[model samples]
Target: MKREGRGEQSAGPSRTEGLEEAVRQADPDRALCAGFLPASVRADVTALLAFHTELTRALAPARSAAIAGPMAGLIRLQWWRDVLEGVRTPDHALAPAILSALARGVFHRETLLRVLRAREAELNPEPEVSPWRQMMRDGAGGVQRAVGEALGVRDEAVLTRLEASGAAYGAGAMLRHWPHIQQSGRYLFPGETAALRQEGEAFLQSCDADTLPPAGRLAALPAVLAARDLARTSAQAGQPRGLGDRLAVMRAGWKAARMFQKSGEPAL
Candidate 1:
């Protein structure tokens, strides 16, 4: 695997400043990903987050809603697809930061294409209520696989295991961001976010110390099951359907947590 140290100083002043500014603008909640990765990996991950932030702005909800959700999302996806297909080059909005990373091999081109395809699928998926679930699962898998491949893990078993764990973790994170998705009138599952957060916390706590690496153990320390359970229960109070929904979410989280636990330590 490539082991380059953080090389921000080697980049041009403008590029360095832009990356730093972008990182400064990054949402703290999302920035938590840094804790899960190595320093070099964090740089790439930060670049990915910057790309996502720019993408979100470029396809702002107000603009998307104006153009209509389906059409807008398709247009955005098509833009990226065009870049992947070599039909067009990156434009100003996505060019500097996102495309620069692509050029430098921070992320694979095919993985970007997969992300666009997944977004396209989400725009018009089957089983309307949960359209994003499968697309998200596949998209996350593709990116994770790309990352693992880039890291030079050729063993198929190891690759598959890493992909699965990464996908589940990605899905869990996406579940937590449901409210943002909802603003675009794209719902993955009713009450799924709350349930996922609730159950995800539980599953993390339930993990035995021996099962997790030191980093994982430290990462899991913040959200014990009790805190999340109380938050979920409190939110659901006086609403029977809310209570039921959270229970379902908790079940899903439990399943995810168990799957992640069994997947063994991440290769990172």
Candidate 2:
């Protein structure tokens, strides 16, 4: 617990902008899609994504046994909890951005709490698809809701769709990183690979990008790309995405941004 916000407050805007650029490079697909959003909305979304990145990195060392132990990771997780609870300011590079988002009321505390809860569960993973699915929904889907709120979208129906999309994207990502995850000694349910792919495909079939509102469409970018990648011929885990794929994602993002500009807000 530290009271170091005075300096961060003075440098918040520039530091947050830097963090947003880092997030964009780290997660290009979502970043490309997010580029279509208004500047303020994109900044909020970047802050949310930065928090997600923090959670993942907090556990990485322990997961790989490359640093201290699981206890070290647990401590890191608790630090975030303290920050979110206003117990103290976080001591991390991403703190300024996250704090700025909170100041603007762009983030949902409950949703972020759910995300941290889900990440904590990953330390000792159960070898079952049911719980794993729940984790994906809570972790990734909660992020979607937070971003939707940042975009000024308060519709429950739209949020629900975004949740499902985020879950599907998370599943697809797990499948794509199967080899790396297995190398980390994490547990995966027997036959879960096929199940994950199936669930992702099912979501793809049901998702209608055209039906999403402009802001909603920006929020759905990662999921849309995930579905398309999973549907590729001979697709499998650990396969590298090509230049063609990047181009396609760019095209979709451009189209979505244009649609958003054309239609400010529609009742739906």
Candidate 3:
């Protein structure tokens, strides 16, 4: 997983731009997908992704230690949970935008809480693959559904497909991050790398991207890119970095847009 940055610590809306930029830098894959969203909701989608970035980064310091590190991460997680629950006003720069999205009903509050809880599970390093699997399903899967809903996908089948594809991408990402995470003395998905990789591949094999609606394809685009990387790399390989990653995302987006355009659906 990419390390999340400590975005501008300021509280007001004035610093929102800086925090959003930091999120863009830290989570380029989702941010790149967000760019393909309709202009009406593009910024809101980025705000939702910013929340994801904050949760992932919160665990950075804890990756090196077992107990105490996770404890510290829990405190950070609680602050976010409380902020979302309205128990306290947000003290972070990205909060305003997130709150605005919430106010506009971009995604349900309970759904976001599920994502938070899923991430909370990540703080405690587990020896079994089940915990990590649940994390990906609820964490990344929930995020894709939320973003898809924000993009005007209302069908339950489409939402389910989005969730499945996103979870597969999460599995791929976990595979990519396994080596680096192990170096930190933590085993997030201990002993199941091969099984997980197989699971992701199976999911992708069944997911026909050409049949998905344009919005659904965009929602699952990261997984498409991840599948390509997995095709050429080993279980321990890292995701495409920097320029290569950007070009890969751009090419995928263009191809997807063209496909949808040919089908008479709106282009991505």
Candidate 4:
């Protein structure tokens, strides 16, 4: 994570701010909704999101000399894994806060393990489609699940929705990165783009339509962004989002907040 601390002070960034920066970079749409986060578990949720970003970037394909490869990613991941599992405690920006959260059962070793596995797989995944989707599910779903857990949600049905929402988030990532991919002069997508769109939509529709609790909706709001972008992609293939599209993201956040405030259902 070469990103400098933007929300921090002289010594270092606060744990929550560190996480907020990560989300702001990884998916600005999600950052737009950070104001909707309830204060109680904000730190925990942000830390989980930030940690997931770290894993994703660690193993990301090297598009430049600056980009780290699988071996470097594995070392960083091992540090996080050891910290989370209590195997070796180390002083770091996120370790202490994350440890405290884990102590309270905000996230378990199992989910973090799956997250690691999926991220590692991204380094060199099978050509087959099923394994790819499963990697998406494990990586994205694990992050969403952690956010939901921070909200104190334990319903199995609602938990299932988080995973689907996560998969939608995965598709949104591809669409979001399209401009950058082309700029890098190496643009490609796996499988049929239409099928990928449906995969995202199907996972989204699989979620219940009813309103969710504020924190619950906050945890699931990425699904809305995914659905919106997928719709735009299908309607106008290869169109880059403009300022209007950016404003729409902010509007969606406002509307999503209103939905939770009024009736627990998002209008977007």
Candidate 5:
């Protein structure tokens, strides 16, 4: 959901200091998860998000042109690889935190590799939507599995269901952002480019209940809404899921939307 940042900072005490300061200065949605996760796991998640945020910022057009397009995607993939391999000596400020967290969590090496593999596939010049979706589904499944494993959820059925729901949410989110990324020569999903343009900004802006389309406003609905709905439905189905956990996920997402909407930012 985020991108890369500018130049890599030297990995030193000063870099760690700066990174921590940046985390401290992050918005509530970004910083508040520390309370939701265990201390150690929270640090890992924060480090991961921070690293991802930096990556997103770097990929932004206003930053360095050297890492744009395919080259940028390669760099991002390599960064992720380093994190997965437990190599923290890179000059980038984000790598160390991610490495430290991975080390602490005993995160699976294969899961990380799976994510990188999907990313590698994405580096292709022009990718189709179905392939992109499959790749994303795989990568997201890997991450969700790793997270569930870390949380001590042992049942395969539970893990699979959780991963599927998460992937659906992720895919939908990527679909919604296709229009913006297409303008920059990056397609998250193949058909998404056309779909988003067809939907248009006007459709996105007309999300209020009064103006919502009968068929469901794909553009108007935030991607998180899809995830929340999945969670709610799962809960209602009498699955072996925890109500508190489902509510927490749903509430956090809606809260994020409310916060963004209040700030006059696009919630999607």
Candidate 6:
């Protein structure tokens, strides 16, 4: 649900310091869990998460001069699309990892683009729970689908489980991010909020932890965090903000990491 800024570790401490700070603010979930993976796996996951964070932020209502308004959002989305299309070189910080993934034939360009398009469409108001759930599905499922592919899990059933996890995570984020979305001139109806919350809980419950491959479970850390957040909050409530949310994310990451230590069971 979060994407942190990532600086190359090879960079000097000063350069990494800023990235670390930004990452801490954006994707604490990734920063905390990276240590649980092997160094090589950590780098790949970090790059994927970084690009996800960029797209997530870019899709939001622009806050600064760098990317402002709906048109700007489309421009940035197109830039990313171009990166995937290979028409233009990847010029962004996270583009390298994405390009590498592409070169290796692991990236899911269509799903990623759908994720971005879903995000772009979110600028419009979501008045119903069904439409909101659909958006959440594409946004989060896009990443999980890509992660599963990159991990080389080809079972359609397993990928379906990952999709459920992604939808659950996205729905919770929609609830948690409701206030911010409102501040950006978009409104979420109370009925829609309740629907989103309920659907998130349902999707999380539907995900059988026993169904995921070990690598797939690793790709599911965000859903784990979402389930935890849902558990800790009321059905009609938003995820706890600030410190509470941070603590919740860490707790979820810890839970997901523990799953890796188990024997033959990677479901959840």
For each candidate, what TM-score against the reference?
0.56, 0.84, 0.81, 0.76, 0.54, 0.73
1-268: candidate 2 lDDT, tens digit per residue: 1324553242336666687678876666566666666665666677778788788777776767745767777788899999888797777777766766665556667878888877887876777767876777678777876777777778788877777777777777767777766767665434656777887766554445558888787777777667765665334555656677677767777887778678775311
Give the distance in Å from residue 178's predicted Cα in candidate 3 to where it truly belongs. 3.2
Off by over 4 Å in 4: 1-14, 17-19, 60-69, 182-189, 209-215, 234-268
Model 2 clash number: 0
Q: Between candidates 3 and 4, which one is better according to TM-score?
A: 3
Write the number of the candidate with greater lDDT, choosing between 4 and 5. 4
lDDT, residue 109, model 6: 69
Kindly list the per-residue Cα lDDT of model 3 for residues 35-116, writing each as its tens digit: 6665556666777888888887778767755557688778888999999998988888777767656665666787688788
Say which prediction, candidate 2 or candidate 6, comes out ahead on lDDT.
2
**Order of models, best TM-score first:** 2, 3, 4, 6, 1, 5
lDDT of each: 0.47, 0.70, 0.70, 0.65, 0.44, 0.62
Residue-level lDDT of model 6, residues 114-161, one tens digit each, is 777776766554666677666766777766766666656578777767
Which tens-of-lDDT digit does each residue in 1-268 have in candidate 4? 1323432221224546656766777755555545565555566666666677777666544434345645665676777778777788657776666666665666666777788888777666577767877787788877776777766667777776777787777776566565565566332346667777777777778654245555466677777667777776543344544676666666665765565556543211
Worst 10-residue stretch by lDDT in candidate 1? 217-226
Task: Kindly list the per-residue Cα lDDT of model 1 for residues 63-128, writing each as its tens digit.
Answer: 447556567656766776676566786564434545555555655676667656665665555764
Of models 1 and 5, which has the larger TM-score?
1
Query: Over 4 Å off in model 6, which ranges?
Result: 1-21, 60-69, 186-190, 234-268
lDDT: worst 10-residue window of model 3: 1-10
CA error at residue 254 for candidate 2, angstroms? 1.7
Candidate 5 global TM-score? 0.54
Error of 2 at 264 (Å): 1.9
Candidate 2 — which pairs collide?
A: none
